[model samples]
Target: MSAASAFDDDIRRARALEQANPAEAGRIYMSVLEQDPANIEASNALERLNDPHRYSSWMRINCVIDPRDDIFRFIGTGPYSHNPIREYLSDGWRTLSELMVVMDKLDQPLTRVSSFLEFASGFGRFTRHLVKVLPGRVACSDVMPGSMEFAREQFGVEAFYSSFEPEQIEFPRRYEVVFVLSLLTHLPIEVWGRWLKVLAGAVAPGGVLIFTVHNEEVLRDQLGVKFDETGYSFLPSSESPSLEASQYGTSLATAQVVAEQVRQALGTDPVLWEECAFWVGHDAIAIRPHG
Candidate 1:
């Protein structure tokens, strides 16, 4: 058959099998792409099938769990509280949506970004969605090797292992956007300034650094403390001495304190400071000045 006729036939078959046998349908759609690299319909179909959000509950459960890695279990079940899978997915969506807003306000549209770095990425939670939205080379890093492996294998992103020490970790190159989600919230006060500087330095000049941190509001509700007076608070993890406790312990900072930390670390005032902007749960946005 002619190329046009063959493409049409493949498209019809792929659509027919999508709901019942998406894997096979995906293969067929991918083959169409191989024949015609610019086939938008086939490309869209393939992307839809591969989207984590569209995955079945069984698939999500499997994706979130790795027998060798306990970080997945901790993040999924710990912060999520109830219905881990659903909440995790929802948080990813909410984070992406809010990031879009931040980008728009900053005049840095997602389309303009050519590379992204997700620091402290845990099992591709947000990295998966970021890849879909950014259309860039997405690289994820975590102190845990298993988490990095899981993100690279499951989310189709480049991955690297990081060190707990801010100065020890390195990247292949700077990125147009560096995302730090739920990471700063757990760092101890001692490393806060240094980590912020290191992460901010990863952004290309004129690029943006977006991060989430527990604000004063959280401290008030959870610990009955006022950040304005104390600046920051840290609740030592009960699981101390374990990596989880050191990396996932409860910490909070006031907006002023966060901005001050950014200024001290990055040598510039934060561009935006929204109390609980991330899923209504973090503060601060900084942009690297362009030369």
Candidate 2:
């Protein structure tokens, strides 16, 4: 077989081995890179592997990860340096790809978006990649300390202080495309609708608000959690160490539950919906506030 097909075969085999034997998967990716140093596919895969995550300037992003940014720390390769910053940087590209599909589904091509917001943008993992595409059009907000500053300084995008209480977060300006990734999946039910309304207000007239959420059925089936009639569940625990457990725990809700919240917040049905479109299991939906 050709070298291209050989790389494909190796990547496929490595992916199959990742869950059961990550070391073997990393070795396979390393072998691919040994043959082809500039292979984007191998580079992205290897970056995510925590088997001593090293940086070889795979993507060559000229940004620094915050020391307190637990999101980056979780997958990073070392204690002193953020070598796996590559994964935090590259996995964000996949997020961009997902947003492309959502934007197309809403008839709002991402390339044409005049302004964008990444709400609750923890450590700018995805925002870094977003700035590469939209540049000056991008703005990021987060409650995490130093998150907004790092985003602004490193990516040259707008940055704002975010609050746990959505009502307290007044934006510098509204956005044509407001994207909230992995945030609703962590909010309690009491504030879910409130936050949704606040985000709806941040969307420019005729613009869309996009976000990701954990599926309620997945909560029940995979996590074995019992949901009430509202079809919501909260674990009061998460990987984030900066936020309060009760305030920013893991959340899951059904489409019906989320739809009602949207109706109450934006007075409109979702313009686009996709199950497991983001992060493989989180549901993604986009709604136009003006409509």
Query: TM per model?
Result: 0.71, 0.76
Clashing pairs in 2: none
The list of candidate 1 runs beyond 4 A from truth reads 1-82, 221-223, 227-229, 238-248, 289-291
Question: Model 1 shows how many backbone clashes?
Answer: 0
Q: Indicate the residue-level lDDT of 250 in model 1.
A: 68
- How accurate locally is residue 223 in candidate 1, as Cα lDDT from 0 to 100? 54
Q: Please give, for residues 118-194, the per-residue lDDT of candidate 2 as tens digits.
A: 89888878887787778689988998878888887778988999887789998999899899988888888778789
Could you give me the TM-score of model 1 versus the true structure? 0.71
Query: What are the root-mean-square deviations of the candidates from the true structure over C-alphas?
Result: 11.4, 10.9
Best by lDDT: 2
Looking at model 1, residue 90 earns an lDDT score of 56
Error of 2 at 239 (Å): 1.3
